[model samples]
Every structure is written in C-alpha cells, then in structure tokens.
Target: MLMGLLWASAAAAEAPSMPGHPEGPMAISSRSMTVKNLDHRIIFDRDVVVKKGDMDLQADRVEVILTAPPNEAAGHALSALPGAGGAMLAEDNVERIEANGRVKVVQGGKTATADQAVYHNADETIVLTGRPETWEDGYRIQGSRITILLKEQRSVVEESRVVIYPDEGSASGGP
Candidate 1:
C-alpha cells in the first residue's frame, strides 16, 4: 500500500519544473514493470533504478504515482522518458514516489539507504523508515527513521545514532 497523499497541485507543464532535476527528464529501468492506468501509477520491481539529473534512486520495488490519469499522464509525460522496458511515466505528472526494500537514493555526494522511502515531490522532501541511514561529509547517521528536507539541506533523525569520522589525512586521526 502507498503511504503518501500528494495533492492535485502539480501544474501541467510542457516540462517538469522541479528544481535540481535538470530539465526534468527522468530515466528509469527495472527488471519488471506493471502499469495500472486506473490507479494512475506505474510499478517497477526487481532492481529498479530511476535517474533524474544528478539524483538516482534504486530499490527492489518502486512506484511512481501520478497527479493525473493515464491519458493525461501520456499528454504530460513528455517530461518523463520511457524507463528502459517500462511504461512511459512522465516526470511532469509525478506527484509522489514510494520505494521499498533495499532503497537507496543518491544526489551529488550525499547518499541515503533505507528499507522504505517516500518522496514528496511538491514538498521537496523525503521520509525514510526501516533502518534509515545517511552518509555525507565524512559523517554517518543512522536511525529508525529519517526526514530529509532537500531544499533546506537538513535532516531529522529519530532514535538516531551519529558517527563522525576523522579526516583521512589529518594528524592524530582528528581534524
């Protein structure tokens, strides 16, 4: 079952307007895919990988939920290219995404891993659960849950354990 509710506020645009998602063309690949038009979603399973600009998400299962119906998505999906053998799910029409089982997301030098992740496109945030972990700037954080504010470059961890690593070249193993 999906865990997020994205409001119908995604503007139908000729291109995806999501910031940091370069020109808004997302590429996806998976071992298997299922299209549920009535549900307005595309499901990918088994080694699913989705790439948009510099960001990448990989999981055992992933779902792309659309703001509009399939027909509307087709009309707007020019912003989203076909992901390998999967259906043409448009990037512009994407409202939210849910990833499950061995989910990993990478953007620039930051990396996150979780058993489950939900991407809130409009909110520009990602919430992760099931042993979530984040690594960046030589520091690592792990927790039962994590919330990342993409635009603000901030993260909140619950039941968190943090580890700060020393600089590799520093004397005395300290910065």
Candidate 2:
C-alpha cells in the first residue's frame, strides 16, 4: 500500500545539517495530531505551525517523516566519540517534511508563501509550488516553482517574476 511505502521511506531517509538553524528542539502545534511510531511519521492538520530556532512554518497541514536511528553497532561506535551521543542522535533523525495549503515560512528577514512546500532534510532543499513567492530585503520573487538551498543561502526560481524596490533617496531622482 502507499501508506506502507511512506512509512518505510521515512525510516530510510537522511537529514542534512541546516544552516542558520539552532540545535534547539523543534516545537509543533496543530488542531489535531496523528503520531505513528511504527511508521515513523507524524501528521498535523488544521492550522499547523512548526517552530525551530528563529524559523516558523505555518500551514493547514504538515507531515513529518522521521529517520531511523543508527544501528546498535554504529551507535556504540559513535558513543565512543567525545560529545557525540545526544547531538548525533538529533542530527540523524527527521528526514523530510511536507506542508500543504497556504504554507508560509518565515526565517530571519525572509518570508516565503506557497500552496505547498516540501522540505528534504537530507539535501537541505525546500521546494515550493503553487503560486510560490518569496520576499526579502526590498525584493520579491514569484515563480511557478521555487527551490531554496538552505545551507547555501541560494534560491532558484523557475518561470519567475522579480521586483526590486529602490530606496527612498534613490527613488527621489534628484541627482
């Protein structure tokens, strides 16, 4: 069944390090939540919000797919390393995330809005679709699809439209 595959994929997925994100815990709130430990997936619906560090994502629904922890042998080896137990545990989980219906993400001074957004933790890439738009630093970009590389601080937009606003003094056109 499709459900089974989704669950299996979650366990096998890998999470990449996210830049500009603190190592603190992630908090999520929603009108309703469904957690399936066996499937390694969590679904939140209705006014869902996920917050971690300085970033917040809001949407009508959100799905989180978690990765499996390292094997016992690997865990033992990792435990031998200095300061590796807890931090490594966190880094090895949380494979992918999906937000749907009026998804909005805000981080620092940047904001992105879309009907749906899928974040691949393994690659630190976020793909936004359905009227995707992003705004930051007096510039706005909208496109059919937008891909953001979190660690690189770069965005690629397909079939895009861009607008840049001039500063007040520059817009005066006196000199």
Give lDDT: candidate 1, residue 157: 66
TM-score computed on alpha carbons, candidate 1: 0.74
lDDT of 1 by residue, 1-175 (tens): 1121111111211112223334445767888877777898778899888776667778999988888765676575523344454554565587888899998776655567789999887877778899887655555667787765555544566677766567622221211
Report lDDT (CA) for all predictions: 0.63, 0.58
Best by lDDT: 1
Residue 124 of model 1, lDDT score: 71
Which whole-number lDDT from 0 to 100 does residue 87 have in model 2?
14
How well does candidate 1 score on lDDT at residue 76? 59
Total clashing pairs for each candidate: 1, 0
Number of the top-ranking candidate, with TM-score as the measure: 1
